[model samples]
Target chain A: MIEIKDLHKSYKMGSNSLHVLKGINFNVEDGELVAIMGSSGSGKSTLLNILGMLDEADSGTYVLDGIPIKNLNETKAANYRNKFLGFIFQSFNLINYKTALENVALPLYYQKMPRKQRQEKAMKYLEQVGLKEWSHHLPSELSGGQKQRVAIARAMVAEPKVLLADELTGALDSKTSYEVMELIQNINDQGNTILVVTHEPDIAQMCKRIVHLKDGVIVKDEKVKQVRAKVNV
Target chain B: MFNRDRWKEILEVLTTNWFRTVLTAFGVFWGILILIILLSAGKGLENGIRADFGDIATNTMFMWTRSTTKAHMGLPIGRNFNYKTEDVETLWEKFPQLRFISPRNQLGGFGGNNNVIRGLKTGAYNVYGDYPEIIQQEPMAITAGRFINQSDIENKRKVAVIGLGVKNELYEAGEEILGSYIKIQGVNFLVVGTYKKRSGNGNGEEGQKEIYVPFTSFSQAFNRGNNVGWMAITAKDEFPITSLKMGIVNEMKRVHKIHPEDTRAIGFFDLYEEFNRVESLFGAMSFIGYFVGILVLLSGIIGVSNIMLIVVKERTKEIGIRRALGEDPWSIRKQILLESIFLTIISGMAGIVVGALFIYGVNALLDANGPVDMFMNPSVNLGVVSAALFILIISGLLAGFIPAQSAIKVRPIDALRTE
Candidate 1:
């Protein structure tokens, strides 16, 4: 569902330029669960950003779902991001003022969906994430695991072609982290293509394939023995 | 355009800092209130001043003869001359623009010794000899009997129109005044009419104490021999008497053989010129009111703009999230602008309501008491209110412009990166 060839990106910091990504090639088929692993400043997050259409690469040939991504204006890029990609952030970036259900319905609101249908669809997603009873609660009132679930529900409600999770469980405790991982695994089992970006080896192990990055270049690409997350609830 | 979600979002964001929002709104509220109050107060002053002119024709001037300052045609300097009855006909023939020219003669000056004796009720008063047209120039209501008409002047009838004050002084209360005889300086004349002058410039009492008699009978009785005391002349509506003053004076100077440069030969009071001055004063007052009111309103708009900028800055993260969720840039900009406009319009309407209430209260208080001098019926008309509303809408747009620009300029990635 995604393709990238010879991707390169650089950032200008006053006089000196930092090359974040240099000549990287990657591909993912439909329904594959991939983990991009790297230490700090390895450009793994940068790759996820380009894949999610949040940031453009300085030089690349990238295609998603048979559509090439190049030189799109802000409006078109936003539409593509909404229709083709979902994102889960480490901070559980739920709008603090909106209830969990409203937050999940926001993407559909931008799509100009009718309000009644949007609410119903958002409720269905919230139920899938096991947060039906908590949909009326705001993010501030939810625990770390529940907030992450709300964010996941929001990301999944639009049924994007791929999910891009950037250190999704980094801010949570280990027990909560496993719970979120189990949720992600369950979502991946339903044949949704997903990309997880993390430095944690245990988190990388939960995926079916791993791509390792070192100093703006891929060091290893290997299939992994998938480890299912065990959760109490 | 009419989205409930958008409205809900605006309400939520604005109420987040409700105290600051209220304080920001007060600026616009106070500005509109001050503007309306200033305009209405100016109108009130104009109304009060205009009322002082009363029913007297504003386009009229009163000219009287004075001692000449220069000698000409064998006439000595400082020779006092009187206008003749034939001079009135000359003026009418010379100036077709002149509407009415009434030559008047008076006897027994305003504080003169008891000039009229009537059944042991003697009093000092001023008596005037006037034609029928003089009533049109210096208007008064004929209360009891008829004013002097053409028949009285043509036949030289010895008849008089007594004022209300004259009636009160000469006759007892509830006594018949019309068709009665009052002897003026040993001449027995019949009182035919009674009048009341409308109150003007604190002179209503003095005006009602005067009396009018036919010009022919007065000249005959007083042995004035075609001599005119002073003339009250009114010009046509299209002509201004002030502009025609010098021409009339010069013509009179020529007729009486006085020097052309004898400025003191004929003294005059131009009511039209004075009325014009008062009109320009009103215009200046209104101009000043608008100038100061707009300055205050401009400061208020600036305050609103400043608050909007702060609001956009505070909601940076929220804007970023909305943008990332495929909210178009125009939609984000529209939300900020909508919020700003809503606040401005609400505050402006409140100001208008409060100003109207204030004017109503002031009018009620004035009604309960009596009219105040130089201020009456303070109010703003519908046009002014509509103009204020238009200004509020434009100010809302201006106040929102910069902040809305800043909001749309935010890149979703950088915004999402911000805490």
Candidate 2:
């Protein structure tokens, strides 16, 4: 479902070029739950942003669902983000002015969904995330766990081909974090491709597979066994 | 988010930040207020000056002989030329533009000292004979009875209209002297109507201390042999009073068989020149008032721009978040732009409504009291309101466009990363 070949990103800080992402090659198939784990400065967040179409790689070949992502312009890339991509951020990234329901329905704005149907779809996704009762509350009015839940709901509402969770449970307590992971695992089981970036070993263990990155390169790839492995498989 | 949704967002921004919004609105509100008030005052002053000229048609040109030191046709320098009735008729006959050029024959104290009214009235009155057409050329809208009619002139009747000052001395009230009899110079004459004296007034020249009698009657009764009264000539309105006076002077020379160099023999007051001078003064005053109003309004608009710049700066983080949420640059631009337009419109409407109400209150008061006694009907002009409203809308758009475009240029990544 995704491919990256010779991807490169550089920054010019005053005098010289600092290459952040060296040329690399990677791939992940459909219905796969892949976790990319690395220490700080490993470019895990930058890779997730590039995959989610939020930022551009300086030199790279990125193919997503058979579409070559590099040749797409800004407007087209934004359109692709609307139709095939969704994001879950560490800080939630929900608009503070909006209620949880409206925040979740935001992606539907790009699809031109009429307001009533958008709200209904947003409500269903909030229910799926077990936050149906808190769907009308603003981000500021919600606790850390509730805010992440709403963000998860927003990510799931569009039913995109790929869900990129960037430190989705980083801001939650362990109990709430476990609850959120279980919800994400359930979402993966429902047949959507999932990618998560995290620094925690336990968080990586929750996924079916883990790719270890070091210094912007993939150092190791391993298949993991979960506590409730294949329970419903 | 075009109209309804855009406005909804604007209302949220405004209601959530009411104090900031009101501060912005105040600038526009006061601007419109000053504009409307100054304009209304300008209109009032203009009307007052016009009324100062009074109801007697000052625009009518007179060809009364001005006494001169020079003589014509080699006559002695000290000799005076009298404009006779024959000369007045011959001049009028030749010039078709002479609407009414009749000799102003007076029957001063013709009723014998006005003692007929006993000691109730003073002897400060005169019975002046005028052609029936003379009053029509003037601005006197008769309050009750008609002016001197052709029949009164042909029959030399003793009927007359009393001045407001004469009415005060005789009948002592309004709309009542239409039937009262007044003894002018000891002769009993019926008052056909009472002329309204222009308000806040003094001096008899403005239709006070006088009575109007038919020129034909007064001429027969009081004009002696070879007695040619002053020529009370009025030009047709289509003709300039100056040109008409010149035309009449040329024709009078032809009739009197005098040379063109005898310009000193004739004297006249050109009311058109007087009207232009006064009108130009009023025009300058109106222009200055508008100039000041616009200057203040421009400052107010600049103030609005300053405050909006501050608002954009204060909301940088909020704007960055909105931009990153997949909202287009246009949406950001539109949101801030709508906020500004809403602020300006709200404040402008408030100012205009309040200022209009104030002016309306004054107009009502003035109407109840009557048009400016010296100036007629100095009230609010709907034209001025329309002009002001147009300026307000243009100012609204002008003051909002630049700051909002600046908002659109703010990069989301830069804004979000700004510590």
Candidate 3:
């Protein structure tokens, strides 16, 4: 669950400041799958970044699971991010030196889990993504869809309260994108709260709710008619 | 302390870029190797030079009379002079600080030869008529009997202490030669002892060719008169014997009636000053060894630092991922620092091992060949080597510092943004 009130963010470019996000307000409830949609410079990514706690909103009240995420120290913020949020980047940022299983186990390692149990739990998540057979494979060795799957496994392995995916299927083929969305949909059905950031209408429709942004402000919020991903062979 | 996962990570990172690792390590390897070798070689050089002054007490001063180069007080230039037995007594009374003062008289005075004979066996030797104190100055490893004693000098006894070489030449192996008679210059003298010089100036055989007789007996029998060829005096610990030599020389000038300003009137050889000179020479050599070693080590550590900088740059993404995964800045810093230190220590250890092996090889060669010119028994003290390793560890940490700071300063957002 997340809440924001009058969030603002700006970027300084030499002599001028670009107001990226201005007076944005949004919310997502428990177990709700939401998609935030906007074109380039529309501030959807900025809003998502603020929600991910990777960037601070200049003037806003952000509440995630009843804790006001404001002005936390670096250490406390990192701990909160580790405990409460999982992130999936467009590029599927799996450390190239580590195998898929090791990548999935990384967050658990920071959690101070014993190496053996971490690997076991990572293997379980890998199996959940249908990637148990490729656990030992490197990210470079995997296809685009499989890499995204590995990233998804890594994201959910820690079982964080919120999952934030920024353009999760942006680099995949349409068919592979459908499969990744189906996996995300399945994860959301298991009662995990998820937010997908995408500009694609079909991907936005796959979520239970869609929030549209323009000029750094939310323009529309509506319950979406869920379109299930057709699982191809 | 041994974490298998951390070790696996380090090994993977290092092995993935094996070429760069070895290249980086070479700097430290060569540095430590040269450091050890230079130190060991310096030790060898010191030992070799020290051997040249073997058995001669460092505090001993050899004073001999020479021709006067400048005349004063009615003494003409080019006047030859010699110290006598009475002067030795006078010197003793004047300077009681002279612990062992002995006037040495060789065959025909100085630079003379005397052939020793026992039955059909004969060996040529440089004979010395010396006091019992001579044994203290140039220690002899007595093999058979006693040396020249007070009674022999007082009574002018015809007793001789033959050298080991003389004993070997004249007597059969295991022969009872002590108390036996030996003929020197056709004069029969009873062999009171057989001795060998404990050390030599790179020539053990030469030391073995010497023989000692009572000074009184030598002066009386060889008609040496009252003329002493040279005087050797070893002072009681009040040293920098150069001042003592000057005092004695000035005293001799007053007693012997030579000119005070005549520099060439006495051949003053200060063993303490000579030893000091040699010591300072070796000190300079050691300083140079350390100076050059530090410079090389500096460059090597700099190489390590440079490589660590590049490594940090290359791993920015991985570091960002770790940060995003909730790793602290301190953890990132520690990781980079550990890697740098590991590289230095492993490579440095290898260098030390190889350097030790090389030194061992040199020592083996030296042993096989006996004492060589300008080099002997190259070795490094364990404490020094251990201290060197300790210094290397600190260097490793220092080399890692800047790179680790760079790693710590990497912003998670900026690094993640880097596609």
TM-score, structure 1 vs. true: 0.85
Return the TM-score for each candidate structure: 0.85, 0.80, 0.81
Question: Which lDDT tens digits does candidate 1 get at residues A47-68?
Answer: 9888877789999799998999
Decide which is better by TM-score, 1 or 3.
1
Between candidates 1 and 2, name the one with more favorable DockQ.
1
DockQ in order? 0.53, 0.23, 0.50
- Interface RMSD, all candidates in order, equals 1.2, 2.9, 1.2
Instruction: For candidate 3, write residues A189-211 as lDDT tens digits.
Output: 99999999999999999999999
* Per-residue lDDT of model 2, residues B1-419, tens digit only: 46444566677777777787787788878888888888778778777766666666554776665554565666566555667767865776777776777667655553455433623656556667777777755545466687888899778787887676666666645436676676655567777875655544455354566778877666665544445557766667687667767877877766555567767667767778888887888788778878988888888888777777877886776665455445566656767776777677778889889988888888788878866554444455778777877887777677877878777666654555554
Best by TM-score: 1
lDDT of 2: 0.74
Off by over 4 Å in 2: A1-5, A24-32, A50-84, A109-112, A159-161, A208-233, B1-4, B50-60, B67-126, B140-145, B156-158, B167-193, B201-206, B224-273, B298-300, B360-382
- Model 3: residue B50 alpha-carbon error in angstroms: 2.6
Write model 3 residue lDDT over B1-419, tens digit each, in one string.
26677778878877888999999899999999898899889999998888767767789899898888887788788988889889988988988887888899886322444467788777678788999989889888888789999999999999999888877778899889888998889888988998978564656777787889999999898988998989888888875577788899899988877888878888878889889999999999878877898789889999999999998888888888787777767767877778888889999998899999999999988888887877888888997689778978899999999999998787787878866
How much is the lDDT of residue B142 in candidate 2? 62
Shift in Å, residue B349, candidate 2 = 2.0
